[model samples]
Target: MANNQNAELLDKARLLRHDIRDGSFTGYTSGLVPGLVQGNVVILPKVWAEDFLLYCYLNPVSCPLISMSKPGDAMVPALGADIDIRTDIPQYNVFKDGELVEQVTDIEQYWSDDMVSFVLGCSFSFEEALLRAGLSIRNIDLDRNVSMFETNIATAPSAKFFGNTVVTMRPFKPADAIRAIQITTRLPKAHGAPIHIGMPNKIGIEDLAKPEYGDSVPVNDDEIPVFWACGVTPQVAIRNAKPPLCITHVPGKMLVTDKLNDELAVL
Candidate 1:
């Protein structure tokens, strides 16, 4: 990280976070704030927060807990000094009784004194790592959100939080797939490595062209689809648990943080 480059990355992250907090930028955060970490937002009441924490512990690959806010607190000082969880996320999925009630850009109206915000590491951080390694990620190149789908693979259950895992797919040549695995394995907090590779049908995914979330990108005949455990997995579990009130970032719209992606990689 050169001094100039680091400064530029920090500037971009700051500007983007400001836009998000101000309710101006409300869209997919993929490819934005290139070298910084972006997280999946999940806000739950104190009564349900402990159970959700246990869920993250059980399904680390999909729900890797990064920075969690103190109960009844809206600020995550660990991720960023000025982050306000209530309004930092670009978009939120408001769920009631396991069903989505509405999608909103800001969650200030839903904020509660008992609410606890949990920030989970997202694949966007690792995508930048991949790009830096010279691997071509189709979704990023095409300016589209990574393709995500529900898998038959079930996540480890904890109390009321239990459901099948959800995964994001990126097509790659054999060599690139191998390199991606090597590179991503170091970032355990960012979902680690691909849960399944090559065979979508083997994992109960019926169609690649039609994904459950995000837009579909081309997967050439010679390319294999590489799947990574996604943060959205918890959203499904949250819905299953059907808490009285639940909120999560709409898929692809993340909460930008000041932490660098490289800082999260493990040897």
Candidate 2:
């Protein structure tokens, strides 16, 4: 099912996952595996999984589920046969009762038999698509983390998981922004389309220099900020819900999986 490019990309995923598992790769995973899908990781106990699943269903843009492992299972067979949720991701954010208590390179000690791991499609998938289409992503080009912010836009609530939407911003020239929009619209599984463009203040973002999550890069005057619903939206919901225990990928760090970007395209 993989082309030569995807095979090369998958090899990168394996190597990157190995590095992450071994505590060598702790930085944000951007532009690592060019074609393989990278995902936002969320882990929760079975008692809390249902509500989160409902939240994901109610808010597809913010929580696009690519694959979810069964309760008590660590391997995500759909994404990769050997994915060990406890260590494959570069970093994990541990939340306790709505607060981020710790961040670690691995969650082996934190893993429990009743835990369920959810892997949501990431913007990295469509970023690759954009790059192939000749669009330059500011974050990647500058080698900095993408800018993400919590917006005033509220996600449709499901159970106790309620919070405002989180968005990732990328700057582009107007014409290139239009083409980027058309390119990304084809990958619904990768958060489909841009939710806002041009003005950050309109979306409750007061400062472009300071992002709520990830590193903020310089935005050129000739370029406009384009925003997309981020997978971090679920993490924000988890924080609001204040579950007893929750684990998520550290903002920009993601789980590299074997799926191809085009494989997730809708049209």
Candidate 3:
């Protein structure tokens, strides 16, 4: 019954991710796998992983860790029974010396014995919840990546990993924004409530139209820009850490997990 239906839905999402890895599908994964939990992937050397884990613990709002694999373990059974960290994600961004060097669908060639993979909760799961509650996510409605920017808000520092938090913005009317906050607050694993609302400049975001990452959605006159701490914030920390090598899922192309969105609800 209910479990079987959930499994079926997750299977479909896994298939979609498989297609993405095989090049049959290469696009933003938002709204594609509804009801399933999607995640931001971070693969780093075991040497750097401990500090990164501490960073997540310190800044849970932006880096809500869902699961982590042992050094060199590619299969994260906790996320999906069949998940292969090397190929399960839709896309991966490779960074060297803190610079993005390339983007690829799979990372089998790059996998190392010292590598460890981490999966963090993504905002997409909560956005799905909002949609189910009859709230409109401007970026989803416009078929774009939610606007993201580097905020002035600093994350709680972990040794060797410290940077300003990055936030994703969605425009909603005042009432809808308040309701959205309430609904999202139930899912802390997926960013929970927004960090700031109504004032973009107050957060150090100069122009909402020019986002640091992802596509920009038009903000209607009646709506205000509401911001949520983003999973991508870790990438900013990675840049600050300047690890010899780091890998992450390309923004908007998350790892679809077997877990249900409802299963992650706090209340």
Candidate 4:
């Protein structure tokens, strides 16, 4: 019965993803599709892909590569059977000369033969694991996107890609933070473990109430801020690289995949 319930939930989530892809849905997919794997999307010219792939390889904690598509190919068979790169995401950020120029729900008008698509593991996958362990996610409870920041930690450089890492923060009591680290450690694809716990200023963040990206959620007086390596780190690298054209999903929006969260477990 438990398995059946999960299956039903997966079906519902899959349909939601499809609706978003087809232009019927245009909302953040935070807790709507529970138990399904969500991914960060990056599309770049083939000329830039090699360095980007290497960057991901060098910084596995922040950008764990889940799947990549052949240049000009719109489908990622490993993620979902009908996943179309140009239309599968709820929102896209169009960057020109390292700055965001526009936001769109579909990219078919911008698709090109020289483009390559990348799907990176998102922290949402591990949120399912955390919930299974009976830990609460503050952002989910508050109906907001997870708070993310630009950390002082720099990623290992790879050719044109070099920038500071970006991270998402979730507050938990000290005991819950430790358990979150252990639970997330089992899912390396979704950013393994917390990079910093307790001290936000030590990581160069000025205030917990203000975030570099996504919505801010409150932290209780007794809870400590726990930081995880976020997939958004690649966007900072893209900006640094300054490619002629770069595309990525908007901060909270992501590509919902067919792969099960358990399939990504390391142990």
How high is the CA lDDT of each candidate model? 0.91, 0.90, 0.91, 0.90
Off by over 4 Å in 2: none
How displaced is residue 156 in candidate 4, in Å? Answer: 0.8
Residues 214-267, candidate 2: write the lDDT tens digits: 989888989999999999998889989999999999988999988778789986
Count of backbone clashes, every candidate in sequence: 0, 0, 0, 0
Colliding residue pairs in candidate 2: none
Please identify which of the two predictions, 3 or 4, would achieve the higher TM-score against the true structure. Answer: 3
Best-fitting candidate, measured by lDDT? Answer: 1
Q: Global CA lDDT of candidate 4, please?
A: 0.90
Native-vs-model 2 lDDT? 0.90
RMSD of 1: 1.0
- List model 4 lDDT by residue over 1-267, tens digit each: 978877786687679878997789887777766677899999999999999999999999999999998999998888777788898899999998789999999999889998999999999989989998999999999889989999899999999899998999999999999999999998899999988888899988999999999989898999999999999999999899889899999998988887788889987
Which stretch of 10 consecutive residues in model 1 shows the poorest summed lDDT? 1-10
Model 1: residues with Cα > 4 Å off, grouped in runs? none
Predicted structure 4, TM vs. truth:
0.97
TM-score for each prediction? 0.98, 0.97, 0.97, 0.97
lDDT of 3 by residue, 1-267 (tens): 987888789779778867866778868888877899999999999999999999999999999999999999999898788888898777899999899999998999899999999999999999889999999888888899878899999999899899999999999999999999999899999999999998899989999999999998999999999999999999999998989999999999888888899989986
The reply for model 4, stretches above 4 Å from the true place, is 1-6
Clashing pairs for model 4 are none
**Tens-digit per-residue lDDT, 1-267, candidate 1:** 588898888788888888987888898999998889989988999999999999999888999999888877888889888888888888899999889999998888888788988999999999999999999989989999999999999998889999999999999999999999999999988998888999899999999999999999999999999999999999899889999999999999998998889899997
